[model samples]
Target: MNYIIKIIFLFSICTLVVAEEAIFHKNLKIKKDDTTVNVKGGFKIIREQFYKNFKKENNLDYNFLEVTKKNPRHGDTALELTVGTGCIGSKADCKRSNFESKKRVEVSGRKIGKKDDNVWMSMSLLIPEDFKWGGRLTIQQWHNDIEVYEPMFETDIKNFVGLTMKNGSRKGYFVLDKPNKNCSAGSGDGSTGANFCIKSYQEFKLLNWDELLSLKGKWIDIIHNIKFNSDPNKGYFKIWINGDLKVDHKGQTIWKTHGDVEKYFGKNRWDFKFGIYTTSKMAFKLYFDEIWIKRSCKGLKLKRLGYKCKNLLDQEGGVKPYSIKDISGNPELAGTL
Candidate 1:
């Protein structure tokens, strides 16, 4: 009898382990890159449900009220909204209220090249303040251009990640200066500009003209290797262009303020902001294939927590109307890390 009871207990333990292990690897899609883990089959984003949750989730608030633009220079379907663009307003006020009310901000169903040509769509997620920054933000576009920005309110500049454009152009520039006053400007030529401060976060500076020219035709990847050291206000910032070292800064200081992080994250801590911003006189197009965010890891074992692929079909078997969860799945798991 005793032996039988022991055997039963052992079986139950084994079954529990198997169940937990299955849950971990069930929706995983692994890649050649040992560090990459494609996520799958979790909480699917139902557009209507998600919009409702966006309002109910008090921890986070999104402002995506649509505005109409009159005599739009573009086609009848001039403006389109994608993932991140919808949340332009919160309970407080419209972040884009400064823009002309007539300048419409709506979601379009058109495709930019092989990708969807959605305009003015922005996505934001509320993470815990103590949540460590992991993974990398990968943005790939085919014919449309995107503007990526990180506004860290509480954390300093060192905690912030910079943006890298691939086969595209970006306008407008802002620099973080001492005290409260910061420098604001636009790109000189029709090229993209990197807005970073060297004094605060070491090596967090814009790419030179020559470096920018080199990455014109090909894809550009910018990885922010953050070093969390003694000073909470200081850290390191490094960038890799096309898998090559481009910018590396040590002992960087990033300003930490309630307003900065709140402006982006709506709470405070670490947040990422990215969108498509064209030149005032002209509109640009760039196609994005993938966008992901990476967190800091010991050694070189970095983990890809979140990623999105373009043109991902939905479960309904249709392709016209798109969504984030349709194509964005967890990186598959070949084995264990």
Candidate 2:
């Protein structure tokens, strides 16, 4: 009986390992097609499917999303997300009725990003020629969940980083933030008070938001490599625009809860949201294609584009991770931004 139990236990362990590896392998190529983008936790809430057949067929309920073959980055089809007039702001998933009538049609990857996740993502974005710039538009953001525990003590705050474009300006900037040390229970709401009492907020402006007007009606590739960590020394964020290294910042990329060690810390509590999220009255359209997310750079195949991945040896003192100084000295990444 003991021998038979041991055999069954080993089989179960082997099966679990195989299942884990299969998920990573399958995620390596998250279907590039339009109807099946395979973004886990794609939509937030389903109020009511106005178009029931579309939801049944594609597993997507939004009317603003479509699959087009006009100008795909690599494949035959790309996703086009639009927000037009007469669109009900409350129909979409957002905090407080379209962010105070800001309007949004987003794809939520609410299950992807997590604590201590070394995530790499690459995608191509197109700003249509007729896209009207008005107010603030958040193209992509790495947002954390707002947890209300016990006596209504909100924790883990807002997004740590986002890619934003403003109205009447050709320049774009990255919004980065960390938690406020002085925050306590029953603090201010996230809508006001320095963006939910964010302690460290920095906007790193590198180049044109429109890429010198050359990106209009054209596709520009963007790549992000993020090491999500609350530790100031271990976390790093790197971005490449049009295959050129544009932003490299080292520090905390996510916020942790205030108390407890086992329950609060080391939890996967972050996600990624993309697509047009704007406050402008004018309707806007955007295209996304060639979207890829991976766990490591070993298979990104971006070496031909002059991309280099740093190798860290986590020994006693073997090799340290690349710093801002090292990135600045590299000729391939120096002059572009």
Top candidate on TM-score is 2
Q: Model 1, poorest ten-residue lDDT window?
A: 318-327
Off by over 4 Å in 2: 1-62, 91-100, 147-196, 209-212, 260-268, 301-337
Q: Model 1, residue 317: what's the lDDT?
A: 21
- Over all chains combined, what TM-score does candidate 2 have? 0.58
Which segments of candidate 1 are over 4 A away from where they belong? 1-206, 228-234, 251-266, 278-281, 296-337
Q: How do the predictions measure up, each by TM-score?
A: 0.32, 0.58
lDDT at 55, model 2: 42
Look at candidate 2 and tell me the lDDT of residue 95: 33
- lDDT agreement with native, every candidate: 0.26, 0.48
Error of 1 at 203 (Å): 8.6
